[model samples]
Target chain A: MKPSISCKFNRFDLLLSLFVVLAAAALALFFLSHAGGEAGEVSIRDGDNAPYSLTLDAPRRVQLADGHITLVIERGGVYVEYADCPTQDCVRTGKITRTGESIVCLPNRVVVTLEGAGEFDAVTG
Target chain B: MKRTLAALFLTLLLCSCGAPREPESVQFFAMDTLMTITCTEEDLDAVHHAMREIARLDALLSRTREESAVSALNRGETVEDAELAALLTRAAKLCKATGGAFDVTVAPVVSAWGFTADEYRVPTQEEITALLTHVGAGGIGSDGEVTTLAEGVSVDLGGIGKGYASDCAARVFKEENVSGALAALGGNIYAHGTKSDGSPWRVAVRDPFDGSAYVGALSLTDAFAVTSGGYERYFESGGKTYHHIIDPATGYPAESGLASVTVVCGEGLLADALSTALYVMGEAKAIEFYRTFEEPFDMILVTQDGRVVLTEGAAALWDTSVAEHSYQYETINKL
Candidate 1:
């Protein structure tokens, strides 16, 4: 007894379905590989006037003011706190969620970058 | 089912084979340029030794040298040492390059202004000109290991010392066969290769107006980047600003549109000197000076207006996304 055309078509459909699943898996993996390249953050200090610190708060408020800046930590990742300038750029630099993220204020000249919280042996004496 | 299993195994095998290997980590400090060498732990001792050597060079070439070798030369004494000989030779070249703008012999003026210590009081014009009369590159001369100085003259190589140290440390990296590393002394930076991930090291240029902000980023591989700014040391009095980098001619702090100058070049010595020269020359002359030379250096000049000017090469290496804030691209070369 010979198989019907419908039965043959069903077998082909199953093979096609398997191929689609395998390709999807590979695509997902490629995305992950690219995503892994996202790296550590860097903090830049402007060495002029009064030295102000711009710290990364995972999530919270940012304040900018006259040669002074503070980062109010709202949540756990990163955010800007204090600044006393007209632009309030530091305050506008919302939250830093990722591992290597930054918040920068130009008017006050503060930059806060996150690079894996742990200090890697680069000590200055 | 067997065929499908074979295909799956092959895919896994290919993925594993194509995975990227981890990169090495190298570390050290000199010329305010902290170096991190990424290599095997087997190379750690060599790296440490090289770093200490660099620090020693720093002590020798620094303003502290007033107590070290430069003082001996200043007091009509002759001293022939490997460190002093090398430093004096480099000083001569830098002095010529800046057309006397980057003189190592300006220490007498530096001291007269009371900037050598924490004393930040502004000096009177008479006091500055009196000292300037004795400070110039031609004040000191070397005759094959024998250094002689004119009366009432002193030399200060602090402006160019860290850069020289950085260059020497880079040589150590090369001699030790380091594949990749970065040295950053405060704002001075040198690199032998990219990070383990094969991306160029990105250095931030600080804004001169506000110390807490960055002007922009400079991406470099196997190069050096050094910055000099007015705010490094200064005191404000009587509604006037006084900075550290003084004009060799006027015996007063240099005033220009540039807030800071960052030079990227092959050696730390050049980066160090050029950064200072540009600081003194300001934006216009700095751009002209950079263009006149055929060297492979790129410069980032930040003006007091928060404007940024980059050499064509530097612009290509920078991360444009962050540069948009508090910075507008300015090509001062045409102006």
Candidate 2:
């Protein structure tokens, strides 16, 4: 006669397995959310001061270097609206919409860089 | 079974906890450009120290700063700073190595073109000729402690300052025992170590023709790479375009038939100087130089004729999958 075996999971076992599954899922989601380059933010560095970041979800005009520089964020694009620096190279950079692009005003010691996931860590030219 | 499941979950959590933390980045302006240094959060102090070091060098080396040692030398004063003297000596050596293709004594010509003051004017041929008289490595003199310049000659370290600054940052990183770091001082880049994930840092070579795209990317670790291109600084006047990389030979923009040149080596200063020198050397001569130079260095040359040429060493780490398909690619092996 063939013997038949039956296995049963208790309430504690089922709860424990479910908890493990949920916890793993939660960890995966957390990592996915915190991955680099997903956040479309604009980072501005002025001299030795602390860097400032702004989300690109809205349009805004930001004055920097005590009104010496005027930065504009419009329609997911960033550009230098006005700069009192002599070179005006910052203003000539035009608008940067993609990640990794930057406008640097050497005289003012201001660098406005677009932060997100870029193809390369740095650009050399 | 329940115990096994619990152990697995615990292991997963521990693995997640052990993963590398986010890097702390410090950005500032120095050497007349934007500089960004990134390292582990625990090594943030080292980054700050590096910044201070770069600032000190800038104060000492800046040509525009009246109190700088360079300014003193430019004023015909024998500046007695050992650091400045050493740098001047090194600059002279590099200028000689490139057969005077790159010279720090081209400062007057650069100023005459209005590039230094941003006045934006095309200097007359006669004016350039006069300025060229002062443009040569021999114009700088040093006695290992004091530095001097010829009567009409001045020096501008703009071509190599950023590279040397990156070298300073690398020195700091090494002293602090930082795990991994990347310092980008304008077009000069020094990769201290691999990324936290153990992968090499990826640096893209900007396309000379297209400001928005890149010609290729290089994976680097513990290396210095510098790219020189006319596209970075230029002006258009009277239907003519003028760039800042003046050929010391001609007192004018280098018309070497090459758009850009990237030099990769172990030393940041060498990489920086060679990039400019090679760009001025053009394609054929640059390749010949690469084959004959005793020091090991890799190079990438983007020519005006839509060709991307890479030295054998550079080709090993180059990734052209994302490069513009319009340009044909070539690799140069030692002949």
Candidate 3:
């Protein structure tokens, strides 16, 4: 009796299936590790004047300006830093970087937010 | 190949459908006790240290100051300290803002009334009137870092210390990357950010007459709420109750119609000052004062008759159970 094509094909199929299983396992591990270490990003905007400027501080920067006044975003929080406005209340208000936290320069109309960490938790399916 | 693709897609869908992460609850200490912080570990430590620091400041600026820096100032002495300078500056600002309603220089009156460290017997009207002579913030003047007390005037931060503590703790929490936190120091409470549930922090105002029962719970985000209740630090003599929140002008306990006045603001100092200010302003003028401020804030007034009136923004969070037997209050903004 001659060897059937089915038997030859079964041997090849088993090796292919094993390869797919190993690849899936590797991908799943990589996905989980990345998810666990993800950090959040928060954007702070200076809300004044024509072509208002925005300062980002997830990295770092000094004085940034568009037109009317120069604002500064350092470390994580944003501040008026330097302004031509009287009272300097915005500068006195100091830094704010937490979520829902802001140093509004009512005069300049700037709002800064400290972004929350952890986009999603393990218990929220 | 088709079968393999189908299996791969099925696995991917299943993995995606699985549960995500759940946030861990954080805890800490404040309000003169062990307070659980519902925040990160670093934030927890920062808040704890801040509270201790505030308490130290209180000891230095307290109405019952024996060895406090303000006491030294009362004795006509000059001191060089950063905390003292900051507290004095804020104290002066509060005096100006509240029209002397929130005077830190009212320590002599507080002491004469037996609300001080000795907790002595209540004094005669004559004694209170005598001590009032030297008890005004105007007596103290500063040129930048140099603060000089005029004769016998003393400073007390008790009316505002707890609120300041809450402010300090909040400041540290924000600095240390705390997402949201609520610090309650006695009757003074401050909350920041949305909760882990993505809702604003909810705080309950306890009834002045009954310690166990709450009058109502008000919800706020990134605001400090302080209550100046008639029940706080009082003594009864001849069927008359003498409580804290004394009126500076009259040198007597504020005769406001409300049992408690709660003021909410961005920081504890303002909340504290406003609470005292509103209590002294009485209901009619308090409403007027609330509208006068440029910044956005809210207030809840619990009258002596058990009626509740909340500012426009805080009216939405009135929990009927806590405010049982109380009627809803309309805000000036609504009118």
Candidate 4:
């Protein structure tokens, strides 16, 4: 009696393997890039410009194109007290006390990032 | 032929399944602050391993924990941890070098100010004087692995634990095949390698008077920039401010005429130790220590009077253009 086993690698098998590998790579990439920030730091942007950082330790109102953004530092915390935008979403975002928290008003092109000092790639304390 | 195909498929699957992507980040709280590890890696395991190691050290070194090495000493027992022994030994050397400025046995004095307990209090002279007896690092006894402190004396590695944490993280980064990474423990920073962009890391010298503003920035790579500041952690009592860094001799907050001291060098532990030591040593003594130091290191000091002085070699690190607040920058020689 004789017994034989044969293995095959078809084009479809190769394509399927490639697809699986690509999908896994894509998923990992998505998650990796999404790992952004922590703490309470605010960065403002106007349209297509770069973000201008506003120190959370410094409490002051910022003037944007349309409405004004008020930043208040009270009791060792920073928050967006008021935004003159239409949706009021920025105000509703509440105070961000932890790392990686941010508030953005699309209408006013204002972005407030509550940057956590310790939760960064590199922090100079 | 068929075997090759199977092997290739297995390899692909195995690589895809367990491998973590590069530039992965991990953040957790340890050593009384947020410890972040951002590294170039294909697996999170290395970063996780680093975190576990650091957390273990944190537990072992914590003065507040009953099971910690220091706690063991406080209870008149000995410890047998390699890292603890090494830390205590190095701290002893630093204390001697800085004329007992960086004493681990200053724990009683530090805790007396309520910085450790979160209950701020100004200890009376009598209280401080009593605590000062056990203040110097001369009490730390180590024999290779096992170590002990003098009876009634305790140790606190807060002066250098974070720096050692950064060093441990850097080692893990290398073992994990991470090319470039940053390990930061509050004001203690270790730019393990250059940035992902292959440029030097820019670290700001925080304003000693204000947390929100920086006095200047430092360009560094493969270096640790650790700062000891009166403003880092402080409490106000009756219009007077008391900081966490205590002077062993006086049993009080150091009046070294320095608002903050930043030490930059290749070694994280040294930078951390030197920053604290130099802060307590003041400018003149620090310059002397610098001259006598075997290895090269740079220092940036913000005096209580608002003068910024850096070793001549340290100018490359400080970016005067980036400071939000104006500082009177002074360049000092190796005197």
Candidate 2 per-residue lDDT, tens place, B44-158, comes to: 8999999999999999989888998888888989889898888889999988888898788999998988888778789899999888888898999899898888899899998
- lDDT tens digits by residue: candidate 4, B85-115: 8889988988887788888888888888887
lDDT of 1 by residue, B1-335 (tens): 76567656765665654544443444333433334444445456656766787767765555544566666776777667756766677777777877777887888787766667546677788888788889777777776576777888887777777777777778887888776666655556776776554667666665566543456676678888888887655767799878788878778888878788888788787788778888888877888888786566778887888788888777776655533256788653322
lDDT of 3 by residue, B277-323 (tens): 88887888778777776656788887877677788777765565744
* Ranked candidates, highest DockQ first: 2, 4, 1, 3
* Weakest 10 consecutive residues of candidate 4 chain B by summed lDDT: B14-23
Look at candidate 1 and tell me the lDDT of residue B70.
64
Number of clashing residue pairs, candidate 3: 19
Tens-place lDDT digits, model 2, residues A1-76: 8998657788876877777677777776766555544437898888678888988888999998889999998766
For each candidate in turn, the TM-score is: 0.70, 0.89, 0.64, 0.71
Q: What is the lDDT of residue A92 in candidate 4?
A: 53
Greater DockQ among 3 and 4 belongs to 4
Rank by lDDT, descending?
2, 4, 1, 3
Say which docking band candidate 2 falls in: acceptable
Q: After superposition, which runs of candidate 4 have C-alpha atoms over 4 Å from their true positions?
A: A1-121, B1-24, B41-43
Best by TM-score: 2
The C-alpha lDDT values of all candidates are 0.64, 0.86, 0.63, 0.73
> Model 1 Cα RMSD, Å?
8.2
